[model samples]
Target: MKIISSKIVITVLLVFATVLSFAQKDFQGQAYYQTKTSLDMNFGGRQMSEEQKKQIAERMRSSLEKIFILTFNQSESFYKEEEKLEAPAQGGGNMRFRMMGAGGGEYYKNVKEGKLIQQADLYGKQFLIVDSLPKLNWDMGSESKMIGQYLCFKATAVRKVVGGTAMPFGRNNNENQVEAPTEYTVTAWYTPQIPVSQGPSDYWGLPGLILELHDNNTVILCSKIVLNPTEKEKLKVPSKGKVVTTAEYEKIAQEKEAEMRENSGGRNMGGGGRGPF
Candidate 1:
């Protein structure tokens, strides 16, 4: 009787341990975000009528607003744009609208490892930016707000703006005429209820999961959160593109943009008609 009882106890313990292991491995979360960026319509300091400004804004609406998904676990997260067909740009002009140094492709961040890997498609070439995650010193505020079902707290950080101060728009002739700000103030609203140190885009390091983030002219807000879904997202690290450090990649991008401008003779490359105003 004693031997039979020992066998039964061992079987139950093994089954419980197996179940626990699967649960730990499958624990994950998904957050959906809506992002919008504003653009300065003053092209080359050129005066334009309100009609023209309205037309320009309407044409650039698709690129200015987008939806993104962040799939994250306790120590890792992957952020990327939700897949959808983009509308064809109006008038097929030579000038193309693009977000300068914008977040493109997949961004993988491992908080535990303090590592970041981003896939960037510059011009037609691909680049994998592998570097340490940027550290932001956040000043936690007493302010609180409700984002969806979660109560969030506010935090602010000041970060130096890298690259040139170009508006998030297509290349315009008056780009050099506009003076860009050298610094940006980033504000984030995080929820300790979620208890994860992750956020959309390059914003992170908060004590909780960031639900809303504001950086300069752009805002990213969390629209939905699903914890431990039945199906899990494969949080795999991105490996495509030419491997380069963050500094090296930035230098290469700057050099290429300069080359393009020089070859185009200082003209707006995408705005083939009267110009991008």
Candidate 2:
């Protein structure tokens, strides 16, 4: 009787373990996000002149670029999602570029230099569904929407700042100080489907995968979703350019702009004489 009981216990344990393992979810998908941005240039605490705005707009369009990557794997007990984005010895190819000219003349200029570095942050970053719960402190008012068969909810996230120091030249000198950090809000739409809880860019931490997100000024929309592609590969973390951190990048950019302004003596904001337009 004792021997029979032991056999029955071992069989039940094995079955339970198998079931538990299968209960864990694993998925692989492809998604594309589009962003539309508008630049508001300010000079001397006032709005920039029309001509100045145009020049700044051109520069802004040339400077901004998006950086991200794709990965593939199976869900398993030992799987660590964050490890998938470690730095690759060969480095990930540059993904951001500038759209030059209009119509037939339009072309792309790779802009992976200077302060705009690409590095994935695993500490402060959180995947949408994996991190968020049903309740949050922010407002949840949103229209019902569907994304890839999953019901989505919209919400806004606001970040406010009163005063902060600025390092306008990627320098640690005392001269690099100004009130900046500024206040802004980001609104996003998410869905409960696709269980893993991830999204393009730095936006995440929602009850579901973020399908569409915007900051009132910048719009990022999801165009498509691909599920379990045949390709099985790993995601590589992007390289960190000469400068790291958004603050450091801004400082370097600001210093460059200041130098350009000084060299031009505020006369010629555009033209070949100063430098590349």
Candidate 3:
């Protein structure tokens, strides 16, 4: 009788292990993120007429209201922007495009392997930026908030931004003019129910999925989530574009910014001229 009971217990244990394995493998999710930049381009002691401000605001509308999608599993996530068609070009116009938001690249983060792949575009060129995941020190708070149907906990962290400018390593404009070193507070609300250390763009290292986050003047909120959907494909890491390290990408981006500055006759046009991310 004892031997028979032991055999039964072993069989039950095996079945339980198999079930857990299936659950882990089958869990997947997609998060929709919308980020709005409340950036006042009137900084730097530059003032424009009301008409010029209105025109610039019209041109910056699409850039300010941006959209992103993130597909994630237990340990990995893939992020990209939803493309939009721009208006037709004006005749005999030399209008150039600048990236005004935090979206210069497509990001992939793997928490398990501690690897990251950033697909970035610079000066009409593409680059596959490979580097390690950014480590953010989060201070979990007891306060909680509701995001969609999930109960999320508030967390805060201070991130050391390279400088006042976007690109910390760019040497084009801040040479003689030394901008102050700065930092920004990042606030996020994450829920442990999903159990994935993933979020929009390059944010990660959380106890759960970050549903909403805000940093400086930019706010990224998750409006919807789809969990364990039937129509789904496997997560893939982006490999296309010239392979380079994170530092190398910064160098190339600064060079491009310098070239743009030179072309514009030492004028810092289009805000900060999209640099390394």
Candidate 4:
């Protein structure tokens, strides 16, 4: 035949170019993240009034910008869901009592606004795949730490919170309620010389790529890390709104702050506000 059909088409094009060069060397490259979280509020049993603790730390920094959202492929994912507010009740109150109180008297006129949701599940409640592998089985020692020069290593994981069901309003009548499930202790840090294993927010399980993280007083700090560009892409996984997990989103944010203090008809309004400052 025509020279044995040109040697079977050059051995099927050299086995499809060696499987596209081993799928481009098992593709892995993409980074850029900035995660900063710090929250501490006890108000020691309400009675705030330092302008309501600066309007409960500006409504806990606008409810932590509507419960986190930051992504980037090649490693980095922190999207603990819940973000439906395209102009519904609008970014509800407490910008330090609307710019230093006295906007309409009556201690900011029985504040009870709405729309600005995000009923808890704070720091990285889910979505973590930085460098994959390590969902729990502890003992990952190596702490050489450096962060800025990228040489970090340190890992510790333990997650468990078994019971759920809480809907502090927005759906679920009968004044929703159901609790039990609180246990956490997560500490992480990673940096396989930025070979991607992302970090910052919902901190991913590390093998190489988690700048720093914490649980039990929430503290997500990755500050900065940006690399490889062409208009970034790949890093998305958000969708668990209406609260879920993280102790049923803190029991639907304490039953929506006691149903906004009984519809604000019983205002003692001290420091029962909220924040993520």
Cα lDDT, all candidates: 0.72, 0.40, 0.71, 0.40
In candidate 3, which residue pairs get closer than 3 Å at backbone N, Cα or C atoms, i.e. clash? none
Off by over 4 Å in 4: 1-148, 157-167, 170-180, 190-211, 214-219, 224-256, 259-261, 264-277
Listed per candidate, the RMSD to the true structure in angstroms reads 11.3, 15.8, 9.1, 19.1
Candidate 1: what lDDT? 0.72
- Using TM-score as the measure, which candidate wins? 1
Candidate 2: clashing residue pairs, number = 1
Those runs of model 1 whose alpha carbons end farther than 4 Å from true positions after fitting are 1-25, 165-178, 267-277
Predicted structure 2: lDDT: 0.40
For candidate 1, the 10 contiguous residues with the lowest summed lDDT are 268-277
Could you tell me how far off, in angstroms, the CA of residue 170 lies in candidate 2 after the best superposition? Answer: 25
Q: What tens digits encode model 2's per-residue C-alpha lDDT throughout 1-277?
A: 6755554465355445444433444545566555555543543335567886775565444233232222322221111112224333332233211121100110111111111113322213311111111222445654556655545667787744222233222232244334444556667777645443344443344545567766544566666666666673444333332424444433443454456545544321211110110
TM-score ranking of the models: 1, 3, 2, 4
Instruction: Give TM-scores for every candidate, taking all chains together and pairing residue i with residue i.
Output: 0.81, 0.48, 0.79, 0.26
| lDDT at position 273, candidate 2 | 12
- lDDT (tens digit, per residue) of candidate 4 on 151-194: 56678777654322332322333443323235466677766554
Q: Which scores greater on TM-score, model 1 or model 2? A: 1
Return whichever of 2 and 3 wins on TM-score: 3
Ranking by lDDT: 1, 3, 4, 2
The sequence of per-residue lDDT tens digits that candidate 1 reaches over residues 1-277 is: 6755554465355445444433475679999988887766765445789998888878877666788899998889999989998777695245444364233667899999999998877777888889998899999876777788776779999877655555323345454544556667889999766766899876679867899988766778899988889888799788999999877876776666656765765533222111000
Q: How many residue pairs clash in each candidate?
A: 5, 1, 0, 6
Clashes of 3: 0
The sequence of per-residue lDDT tens digits that candidate 3 reaches over residues 1-277 is: 6755554465355445444533666678899898887755553345788887777667666666778889998888998887779766534234443444455578889999999998988767889989998888999866765687776778998876531253222234553443544666889998766667899888899877899888666788998888778888677788889999877876666566557656765544343422332
